[model samples]
Structure formats: structure tokens, C-alpha cells
Target: MRVLIVGAGSAGLTCAWRLAREPSTEVVLIDAGVDPGPDVPSFLLRDMVLPPPFYWDYAEFDRGYFLPRGKLFGGTSAVNATAAVRGHPWCYDAWGSPSWRWERCLPSFRAIEADMQFGAEPYHGHAGPVPITRCELGGFDHALGDAYVRRGLARIADHNAPGHLGFGPFPTNRIGDDRASTLRTLLPELRGRPNVTLRPQTEAVRVVMAHGEARGVLVRTAQGDEQLLEADRVVLSGGTFGSPEMLFASGIGPADGLRTAGLPVHVDAPEVGANLVDHPYVQMGIEVSDPAKPAAPPGKGALLTFELDGPGHLQAHAFAYRTRAVDPSADPCSAAVTCALLTPESRGRLELGTGRARVRLNHLSSDVDARRMAEIVARVADVVADLASEGALRLPADPWWHADDLPAACRREVVTYHHPVGTCRMGSDTASVVDEALRVRGVERLMVADASVMPSLPRGQTNLGAMMIGHRAAEFLLEAPPP
Candidate 1:
């Protein structure tokens, strides 16, 4: 059987690695990017624990644009902070699909993890393809974790375990000094496999469909040439924006929207590019009197879900790290805390621009969402102030600390956690693009394996969810009768 996976990101690599192991399967993975170069962002972030390779120079884009995703072989995982959180169990249970609930998804999660640390914990899987390890906790992380425990938050030894709510640095997808991206973890294992062919710098143009069934994809090669690749099946892992745009270009979205693009409507799935959700963060940097200790590096520490409720629900997810800027004479004496609003009432959408190929994200599109974000900022300020009162947490005297400045702060400082989801949402509902099994509704030989298939964003990061989807896709394909 021949399978073609589109977009050589987390999901595509996962699928390729799994399928390559099957004697009867032949897999071709195509990505529209360069090779997995040595200086890739994931490698830099994991080794140096710095924030440059993944973080774009926001000054280059409009102030509204934040957290630009990488277009490398490992996808955003190559540039992300490597925080491998499994999310709250309630996130899956509330996804409104039987196959997506925590009980049904845990096996898949367990199947892919290779726990390097905290293996004794019940929630984490010890033996798997991807390794999860705990970093050394610094003084700031230790203090922050203790603060959460003092405030009644449960201290979960392993955040990936079931019902993860507490203070602790979650396990990261890092193997020693290297970032354990799908490309690094799974691809290397399948490098010389006869059945698998990895084609980087090949952008998938559109799904090739015949009589309502997906058969292959048209790809543009690095040499600026277009070619058609045939396969028994096509899986879209182009993420929230790429997948929907591809679907729209192939006339597989809402009739009216497709019409606006001067294209024929094939599937009429109106929700293809709608219902977008993201976790927005408000970062607070503090300068400490002690200049000898720089912030602990990434993967070292994090505190999950510091809940504060009033007129609206506000959850402050804090990451305490040491930085060197605090004291030039001392070692590195600065710590920064970033609080993200997880359960925002606000929502957004992924819309095609005037040009059909262009995509624009309308973030913070709802008044309720904007207001809810404001409330979250207020609550975060309260938490920061509370921490400062104890004298251990020293927040900078920046005017951004004032609650009255939240609107400006929201505009200037808010950024995404890189967890954009629900564009190609999965559900049993007729309007959903994919079913509970992740099969494209009304389409045969086509499936979506990415965070875009998530019906809702999980409480934590989206990497684990993407990995789980890839694992589930493998299971579904393997269990089926030979094509």
C-alpha cells in the first residue's frame, strides 16, 4: 500500500515513521521547506535555552502579528519551547467526540512517549519513540512551585499524568542537549527504510480527488517545478492555516467562501476555517536583587494553571526562569513570569484574504474575548502583586504592571502560545470537516493528523495532542483491512 503524507511537520513525521515499519506499506513524506539543517531553531532552543530562533523579529511584521510558526522540517517543534504537556483530562472529555475523550486517547498518548525522567509516575509512558525528560529546577522555579503549593495547587510529580493540575516543570520533548522533534525522534529510525521516501522542499498544492475520493496530491518542488504524486491515501498535517487553505483551494470548503475565491465548491464544509482558538499570554519580567543566578534554562521549570476567578475566569499559567540581564557583574539575576489566559470567552477565525492563497488570522475577534482577556490581565496583576508582597518575587517597576494599563499591555505584549486549534475541527456534527476517527467527512482515503483537528484547545501545550493524533492515525490505518 502506498501512502502520501503532506507537510513534514510533527504529524507527518510521526505517520511516516510508523508506516515505514510496516512491511506492506510504502510512504512518501513531502514538505515545502528546506532540509533539517544543523542550526535549526529546535536545536538552538534546546541547547542554548535562548528565545531567538523560534521567536521572530516581531518588528518585521505588524504589531498585531505575534508568535510566527517555523516552516522547517520539524515544523514548529523545531522552534518551540519544548514544553511537552498532555493537557487537562477535561479538555479531551469536553471535545464532544467519543473517540477524543481522555479514556480513548490515553493509549495513543502512551504509545508514543519515551519518558527519560519521572518514569515512575503513573501518567507518563516509560517506553515509547519520543523521549520526555525533566530539567534541573533553578531557584526561581523552585520558589514558584512552592508558591503554587502554598496557594492550594496540587503538586503533581508528573504533569503529563491524568488530571494534571498543579505546580511543577512539565516534562519536555528534549533528549539531553538535542530537541526531540518528530523529525529527530522518528525520522532517524526510518532513514534507510525502503518503503519511506522523504521529500523536503516539496509544497503540496492541492488534493487530487476523483469521484469524491482523495487519490493523491499535486506538489511544487524546490526547483520551482510542479509534479503530481499518487498514493492510496493523503493525510493533511499542514496545521491550522495551511490545511484549511489547501482545502479551500481544492474547492472543499463553504460554498459561499469558495465562490468568493472564484472556485467551485466540492464539500461545502463551512467550518473548515472557522472556530479558531489560541492561548494568549501576558509576560511580566522582574529584576531581582540577587545578580549571581541567571534564569533557569527552558525545560527547567513551569507552573501550570494558577486559577483566579471573579467576574470572569482567569487562569495564570506561569513559567519562572532565570535571565542574565538582571546583573552584569553578578552571574544572571533575573526571572520572568508569563501568564496565559487559557479559557478565554473570546474566539477568532482563519479567513482567506483577497488573494485565495493568502491567509489572515482574525485574532481577538470577539468583544467578549477582548473583555475576558482584560479580566485575565487584571487577575494576573493581582497574582504578581501577591507574589511581590512576599518579597521573593521582584517585579519590574514598569508601568505595564498597573491594571489601568491592561488595554495597552494587551495590544503591545499579548502573544500566542503557538496553540492554534479547531480550524479543521473533529466532531460527529454534520458541519465538522473530520469525524471522530479523524477521517475527512464524506471523503475517502483522506484524513487530517494535526492540532488543527482538535475540536478545542487543551489546557496545556498542543505538541502532545499533535503527537497523539499522529499515533491515532497510525492505529486507525493499521487496524483497517488492506486497501
Candidate 2:
């Protein structure tokens, strides 16, 4: 069977790698980004730098904030900070699907990572393609950890450890100085595999549908020509934005919106681009005492995950890192701590604007979210104050977190953790865009295997979870009877 997969990101690449191994199955992987092959560019390899050519410029359209997503072969994983955090066990169990329960998802998670620090543990895998290592805490990180300990928080080294919390080193998908993106890990192995076709620089315009089945994809070639690539199955791995956009462009979203946009409606799935959830964060800049002091390694930082009293016992995490200066005149030595609300109650939506997808991440729109975000900021501020008292750094004259109207301050300072999910949410219910198996509802021969299909935001970085979805998608397809 020939399968055409769109978006060669974390999920797409993983699914392709797994499906290509089956000698009888043919996999065609396409992406709008350049195919760097094994020799990825230095900019893409470097952590904390989101190069323009490799990314889809959301253009500060999401409430005046930039939402960066990779447009390259490896997708966001190739350009992200190489964080490899897994979600809390309850995050999966809350999906309300037996196939996605924590117990069922653990094996796929283990099968994707070779944790250098905890490979021997029953919960981790030592033989996976991606290499996972915990970052070493620097002096500042140690100070931050000390503050958390003083606040009665325990130190948990492994954030990926089931339901573990508190201050610790963040797990990263870094192999030495380079990032272990699928472009480096899975792509290299899939190279020259006869059954796989890697077609980069190809933009998927829409899925070509007929009689409620996805016959193929209509892609715009790199040469500015349109082409139709047919397949028995088509999987949309274009991430939260890209996947939903693909569905909208294919005339398979809310009927009213599709009709207003002058597109034919194939399926009136209202949730196609709804249920957008992301970790809302606010960054507090810290001016160091010594500007000449060298910074810690990129992708290396300490994380403090804690719980807040909410209806769902909401979670949050704060991490410190040296901020990268995009402007030439800005101080490159400045560090920043980001306090993010992991389990936010706010919901956003993705709509079609002209020919592209328009995103509105109604972050902190919920009263619960604003209140808890303020609480998180207040807690993080205490830690920052401790650092300032020790003369390690200087704080802003009027720190936003220190404002009397903290919830309003949080609203003003809120930004994305750069982790967006649930655009094409999956569930057992009819309103969901896809089923528990990741298959797009009402559409045969089509599946969504990426962050887009997540029913809700998990309590950690989504890079690793996205890879697990891809692995599980391949298994689901493989186990099912062929059409």
C-alpha cells in the first residue's frame, strides 16, 4: 500500500520511518521546508535560534505575539530548543480513550527515546532513535533550585518520571552539541530506503477528496507547478496549525466558515480548527551583575514544575535560560525566567484568513487561567527576589509580577510557550475532528498523526509527545485490516 503523508515534522517523519520499514508499504513524505539531508545547516542546528527560512513566520498575528513553527523537513523539532519532556500520566489518562491511556502510551514513548540518564529504568528505552539527556544545572540554576527547595518543594531530577514534580534538570533531545531532530535521527536511517520517497520543498495545497475518501493530495511543487500525488492513505502531520489549515483548505471544516471563505464544504466538522490549547507563559528579564560572564550551553536549563489549587489541580512550570537577543543592540548576557501555566482553562480557535490559517490563542481568557497565572508569576517572583537579594542579578524597577493587579499584569505579559496543540483534536465523540485511532472522522483513508490531534495540552513540552503520536499512528495503521 502506498501512503502519502503531509508535513515531515516530528510525527510525519516518525510515522514514515516506521511505515517504510515494512517492505510492502510505500511511504511518500512531503514538506514545504528544505531537505538538508544529513548535513543540516548550522543555524537550524543551533539551539534558541529560529531562523526565518526554516520557519513559518506567524508574523505576530496571534494577539501581537510571535508563534514560531518550523516549515522545514524536520518541522519544529529541527528548530526547537531540543526539549524532550513527556506529559504527566494523568494528561494521557484524561484523553478518555483506552488506546491513549498512560499505560498504553508508555511503550510508544519508550520506543522513541533512548534516555542516556535513565535508559536502564523500566520506564525508559535505551535503544530508540532519539537520544534523551538531562541538562546539567549551572550556578544560577542551582540558586533557583535552592529557592524552590526553601519553598518546600522537592527536587525531582527526571521530569519525565511519571507524575514527578519540583525543581530539576530539563531532559533534552541533544546529542552532544547538535540537536537530535528527526532530520538527524530518523531521516538519516531512512535515507536510501527503497520504499520511502522524501519529497521536500513541496507544499500541500489540499487533500483531494472524492466520495468521502482522501484519494490523494494536491501539492504545489517547488518549481511552482501543481501536482496530484495519489495514495491509498493520506496522513496529515502538519502540526496544530498546518493540519487544521489543510483540513480547512480541503473543504472539511465548519460549514459556515468554509462557505463564507468560498470553499466547498466536504464535512461540516466544527471542531476542525477549534479547541486550540497551549501553555501560556510570561518571561521576566533578569539583568546579570556581570555582563562579561559566559552563558550556559544552549538547551541547558533548570525546570521547576508545581501544582496550583484549581478545579483540575492546574499545573505550572518555570525555567531559566539566557535570553537570545534578536536585536543587535540588545544585551545578550541577560537571562530570563519563564513561568508558564501548563493546564490552562483558556481555549483558542484557528480560522481561515484570506488564503491562510488565522490563529487566535485566547490565552488567559478564562478567569481561572488569569488567577492561576498570576499565582505562578507571584511564586516565580519570590524566587527571583531571592536571587536579587543574593546580588546575583538585578530586577526591573516595576516588575510586572509585583503589580497589585496581578491577574491584569499576567494578561498583559502573557505569551506562548511556543507549544500549540488540539487544532484537530481527537476523541471518541462526534464533535472531535478525529477518532481515538487518529483517523480523521467522516473521511476514509486519512489520519492525523501530530500535535494537532492531541485532545488537550499535556503538562510538558510536546516535542516528545508528538513523536509518540507518530509511532502510535503507525502501529494503529499496521494493526488495522487493509482497506
In candidate 1, the residue pairs with backbone N, CA or C atoms under 3 Å apart (3 or more residues apart, or in different chains) clash, namely 42-78, 293-332, 294-332, 295-322, 295-323, 296-322, 346-369
What lDDT does each candidate get? 0.72, 0.86
Alpha-carbon shift of residue 397 in model 2 (angstroms): 1.8
As for candidate 2, its clashing pairs are none
Task: Report the error of model 1 at residue 212, Å.
Answer: 1.2
Taking all chains together, the TM-score of candidate 2 against the true structure is 0.97
Best by TM-score: 2
Give the alpha carbon lDDT tens digit for every residue of 1-483 in model 2: 888999999999999988888888899999999998677777677756665787786743557666779888888998888877787889999899998999999999999899999999988999999999986676677777777898899999799988798888889998877888988899988887999998999999999999999999999988999999999999999999999999999999999999999999999999988999989989898876655542344458778888997566589988877765333345766777889999988999898887557888888999989998999998888888987898877898877788899999999888888889999999999999999989899899999999989888899999999999999998888888366
Q: Could you give candidate 1's per-residue lDDT for residues 140-246 as a string of tens digits?
A: 56656666666677876677666556777668888776778876777677777888888988888889899989989999987889998998888898887778878
TM-score of each: 0.88, 0.97
